[model samples]
Target chain A: MKKTLALATGLAAALGLGQAAAQVSDDVVKIGVLNDQSGLYADITGQGSVLAARMAAEDFGGSVLGKKIEIVFGDHQNKPDVGSNIARQWLDVDKVDAIADVPTSSVALAIQEITKTKNRVFLISGAASSDLTGKACSPTGFHWTYDTYMLANGTGGALVKAGGDSWFFLTSDYAFGHALERDTGAAVTAAKGKVVGQVRHPLNTSDFSSFLLQAQASKAKIIGLANAGGDTINSIKQAAEFGIVAGGQRLAGLLVFITDVHSLGLKTAQGLVVTESFYWDLNDETRAWSKNFMAKHGGKAPTMVHAGVYSAVKHYLTAIKEAGTDEAGKVAEKMRQMPVNDFMTKNGQIRQDGRVMRDAYLLQVKKPEESKGPWDYYKVLSTIPAKDAFRPIEQSECPLVKKS
Target chain B: MFELLGVPPQALFGQLLLGLINGAFYAMLSLGLAVIFGMLNVINFTHGAQYMMGAFCAWMLLKFLGLNYWFALILAPIIIGAFGILLERLFLRRLYNLDHLYGLLLTFGLSLIIEGVFRNQFGSTGQPYDNPLPGGQNLGFMFLPYYRAWVVVASLLVCLATWFVIERTRLGAYLRAATENPTLVQAFGINVPRMIMLTYGFGVGLAGLAGVLAAPIYQVSPLMGSNLIIIVFAVVVIGGMGSILGSVITGFALGVVEGLTKVFYPEASSTVIFVIMAIVLLVRPAGLFGQTR
Candidate 1:
């Protein structure tokens, strides 16, 4: 009887040790959706991105390897310091496996460095600077959605090809704007077009009358707005008021979003061509997913950033499941090896430089008479395939991409 | 194509007109700040939020009540002013006996609450206020929008009228006298507290009027005033926050200076005003028109 009792105690201890090991290997997967929650960029990637991320987790069966998935968010307020601090705290304290949907480029760059040091995944969706993949690419960072290169090649190249060649840029004086202007300028030049002039405005400028007048005086065929969010909306509205278009000069919103188009209304934003990676009305799959998002998001349609968050989160979970662990390096490797097929992208492949190569659309804002429901804002002009839409790998400056 | 200062005449004139419009707004807002600061001895940090409220009030009036721009012009200031009076009675009156910094802190907190509430409801995207006076005639040198021209003229009139009422009227004399010795004025049965309340209300009302005027030109957003208020404060600082006429003149002059900077060096336009403020502080700390305290 004493020997049998001792044997039972040994078996119980061994079983307990095995359960502890399993728990350590398959803990909860926590994702932090950090972006501008209360500032200018909030409209595009605020609570909506958080909701999309949650939906992605739910769609992924809510758990991976028996660990429940959790989504958390923070408001970076478009400040770099604030963002990096939150990222460090999330990584160190909360054990967040990934950070996603960082919008502003400066903040995104700051968080990217932190994620690199911690070996956590950084899913960039809202930010538009191509420098993420160019000079700042990280093994753990994935540039999932649109970037400045895509915008420049889509809107700038299309406009130049369509004879709206002479360009004047009203650039917001910052990293994002500078990258956008550089890329668009290159695209214009590549299309055999001339850039007449450009003026750089400070971020969050309330007035653009003086800048618009300068663009008008240049007599550029197109006024390329190298700004986004509120700046883009204000410049476009003032341009309309100043009769910039009526004076025979067109306005190209290089980084305009659907939110901006909604704010401007079709009456004023008409005839302006823009580029986007995902439009809610693009197809049946996008329509269904966006409708689901809108129902969860107070009838607000999902921007590309929100949609990209959903896709990135879903893809990240898939990678973790395939790798059978939450080890950042292993999951990132699996992510790179797998092709991204989702409602947001079809056969989207992650390049070595970390840019998600996917098709982009050049769209024109519909006129008021374009009969449709409230969210039907775009008329698709053209589609640039994934190969032609992004910067070529040979020209990449990212150290991660080796020379062929 | 005539050239002025290495820029085309059309561009230069257009920038000048734009500057004048901006100056008009500065003059109105700074004048309000001066009126409140002169009498109440509080910085009225809520001045910007009040200005934003005026614009939002105009927007709400149009959206909910189907009121036109003209009606909003008349009603928004009065409604916002009434709210200002209530605020003074409930909160600001208690801070009058405390340090000036307390008043500033209180109003700063109030401004945040007001701005936050609006942001929560509307988000940051600006709503368009249709141009009441649309289109413009092409001048020989530049195109002039009728709405912009109206704004310039109306703001000038409003500024001058505010100046006249404060510097020239009997009520103005009483208000100014109360500012000097509130206790003594109270002994004379002049009801100094009521005067202080009215002064604050009137000052915030001026901000409201400016908001109504600015609605068509700027997208009405929660941040509309916060963006412009910092510049107006600099205008007030440069003008010396002393005499009403001083703030008005300084506001217009600095606006022209900023516009000229944009034409010559577009990059410096944003900082030109602050640079002028530093120069003014060094040369004459009391401001161009301020009395030495």
Candidate 2:
């Protein structure tokens, strides 16, 4: 990425543009990471995301095109208004060039509209709704991590193939949950599986037994959890008590992070098949990067969101250097053209619809006695290839995708 | 023989049972609030935090000292109650002479601080507590977990015990006398301040006990209390601010209402409690079991 950026910067300079340093606004390249810093999703993307962007800047030598690289972050608190308010302020008053890592899909979708109108870059590393790249796609936006479509295809498809065919969804009544359910439900239908029933519970609900009872009554072979964070943890915990699993039903965690597994411990989270794009213990490179991250993150492994933040920041800065300017359009084009190469992702492409097309892994949580040590949770089963995994451009609702 | 709104009778029975189980927590929590408001005349807004603290206390007890669920159930409440006694001495005691808002504000701010510290230390993903009784009996219509059944019974026993002590005993006579006229009670040689402080501690203890009951079900997280506290407040208000019997009954009844919402609409489950609270307030300002002051 660095070599490609330098070559592009040189080419742009030769093509009659000013030097990259002179093109930088305010003599600095600023990137802002917006996410939930203080709520239920906090542990997944909160301060750790901020820490990730900083690590990214540091790893990138803290500068691009002879301009200092700066990172700023804010807490959305899982509220869309709060997220957009902070974002508008960052763009107008603070002169932030690009916004990265807005999780909480409702908040992410809101920020998407604002950043589009503002004509600034947006890099999404959180929020699982496939709609970000679907109807809501923007020219300046780039989805770097996982999304609902990939999760539906990865976890949902595999479960159906495994004879956990009949489905019942316990959805969180919000944008992310709705998107996940719709996408996963579609995946089930495509695979000749029947959806028994679905119940949309409010976010942050403490009790899930009533919903679990309804799911049990549906008598579905698989209970597809279309929620994230605390909602997911509670559903799984309560399902155990209600004898949902003991009664021959399987749980499919559509979007489970390592932090969730850590919180749940191997005791309850064991045997749960989850789909995610990145895992820290995947290879030596991931381990080396994660160890440094874990040191700063209180010995906690990086969730895919954290890794996505780091990768997105590094790529965004590279794009700016490559384009020889901080303009949103040129940099975004450069980003889309350059393949995403990092520890967790290999040759990941940013599709025209802003979906980061990358291979995702299907993981099953090892039982309590599977025994390596703490944080040694997942047994990687198979990789869901990028072309086969992501929603094809032909089927996209995104206006950016040219209809053939 | 019967069906209500397209839901089967069997499913309805399961939902009703689930609602009753949820009501157990509400009854326990609102009962604490009523006790404190009835005696202290200051709304104990920290009830949720006290409950969260109780769960955290239980988690810590098991993690650090090898204390089991049974032991933590007894000790977590006492520890949190002792902490509550400290709160009464240090901060809440100073606001008894002022308007009710003062106590509410102080406790609300304190709740933020307490929750903030816990969030910083523990993070919000939540820690899991092992269920003492893991397996359940299949009731044919629904699976009934032994632990959940135990939770309902335990909360009922606690509520009845609290009501008996406050409304029936000799100590209860003096407490009620103090509630009416603390001056006369003090003049009659009763240590009114000490008694008031102990009453506050006891109420907070009830919140802690409810927390222990919830820990096994919901993962122990800092924001766990905040999520349910608003609804619990609605439960208390609809039950009539300081009515013990009112809070106890309203808590359970509202839980069933919320459960039905989850069945029919599902989206309005969180709001149904407040909706009921609004209607109840308009119809009977003093609540179902509350006497007009």
TM-score for candidate 2, residues paired by index: 0.97
Best by lDDT: 2
Give lDDT for model 2.
Answer: 0.91
TM-scores across all candidates?
Answer: 0.94, 0.97
lDDT of model 2 at residue A257?
97
Q: Model 1, range B1-293, lDDT digits (tens) per residue?
A: 56776787767777888888889999999999999988888888999999999998999999899999999999999999998999999999999889999998999999989998988888778677787887888886677788888999999999989889889999999999999988898998898888999899999999999999988888888888888888999999999875688889998998888888877887778899999999999999989999998
| Local error of candidate 2 at residue A131 (angstroms) | 0.9
lDDT of each: 0.89, 0.91
What candidate 1 gets wrong by more than 4 Å, as runs, is A1-26, B1-5
Instruction: State the lDDT of candidate 2 residue by residue for B1-293, as single tens digits.
Output: 67877998889988898889899999999999999999999888888899999999999999999999999999999999999999999999999999999999999999999999999999999899999998988888889999999999999999999999989999988998999999999999999999999999999999999999999999999999999889889998998888998899988988898888899999999988878888888999887777888
CA shift at A257, candidate 2, in angstroms? 0.7
Docking class of 1: medium
lDDT of 2 at A376: 95
